[model samples]
Target: MAALGMADRPITVGAVCVYHEMVSTAVEALKGSHIPVAAVSTGFPAGLSPFHLRLAEIHESVAAGASEIDIVISRRHVLTSNWQALYEEVKAFREACGDAHLKAILATGELGSATKIAKASMVAMMAGADFIKTSTGMEKINATQPTSLIMMRAIRDYYERTGYKIGYKPAGGISTAKDAVQYLVLVKEELGRDWLEPTLFRFGASRLLTDIERQLEHFVTGRYSAAHRHPMG
Candidate 1:
């Protein structure tokens, strides 16, 4: 809701991700509005829950009009080298989303290795993730360039193998316009401009809108605007 009105009053937000219960309210509030509802499902930050519950959460979020579903992969399974089981879990979640876009979250901070990151990226994409995302915003280290490079390379490889162009989303701790631009540059340089649109590129930030507004204000008036609140749409 805040994201919606912010977009109206000079702040442009492509999407707002919320928990499963909040999906319906967000959809209703932002209906006919431009902001897309991206729901965080699949046991989110902890990534420790029963598989059936996670899948049900995905189903409910999609049924509630979520256009995109951000789900965390079971970090435990991935870390244990259970590649086949991990792949099938993601595939099932992808199917559960129905028409909603599926973003498989790697939670890279916990994975702890570039090799693991690369393999996880490949597994998620191959399991039908529309986008392979970085983190859940509940950790200290979320998205880093090296980690992003690994995933981007994995996506490139996947595209080469299957003719599918997967998207990338870097969530958590990306709070500055400079950082956003850097990530954008990374995407453009690594994945090409074809993936620069909101569909393929998104900054999962809680504070990004304000920074963008400040940037836009500078672009228009040559000065920073005072802090303000945008109402729910």
Candidate 2:
């Protein structure tokens, strides 16, 4: 994984997303590299655990030195149109995260429609999430351009209303240089130049970095490398 971080430029990933139990290991391995260990919490992928336990998980992850926490919102809240409840729920998670940045996962693929995805994104931002993510990568569907587009629009609207800048991360199914380039283009076109940076945008993908590195190597040396040569986190 550290080998993957050796790559240069826009192709180099911003953070390595991991599960809670791996947070300490990731933090130790990534030391002095400036790469953040983003751990999934709040009963991630399903988020159906007891509320207290979820909040405790967030604290444990932070205590273990996870720089960011990607928490999943209760899907029932969004499906039932309980906006205030969802806002409060996310806000509690944000508080539990303490100094660690919070990225609320909407699992857009399971939310049923673009409207729900947009609304959930807005509610997460309103609740003080530092970033809004597309999915947990465990959904039947994860991170589509259409859903991502809706989420990005919601982020834009939030920025316009509050004058606060929230980050965007499109996790799952984003592989290859073309897909990354497309996402970059979307951010550049929708949110402008500032959002192009890692502080604003990220890919919560495991294999995406290898592909991006391969493309970079091909561009520079005019040759492609084996997948094993680019060990990702």
Say which candidate scores most in TM-score: 2
Tens-digit per-residue lDDT, 1-233, candidate 2: 23445445434468887889899999999898888899999888899999999999999999999989999999999999999999999999999989999999999998888788889999999999999999888788998888878988998999999999999999899888899889999999989899998999988888887897788777777899999887773
lDDT by residue (115-226, candidate 1, tens digit) is 8899999999989999998998788899888888899989889988999999998988887789999999989999899889877887787777677767766776787876
Root-mean-square deviation per candidate: 4.0, 3.2
Model 1: CA > 4 A from native: 1-12, 228-233
In candidate 1 the C-alpha lDDT for residue 157 amounts to 90
Candidate 2 stretches with Cα past 4 Å from truth are 1-12
Question: Which residue pairs in candidate 2 collide?
Answer: none
lDDT score, candidate 2, position 229? 84
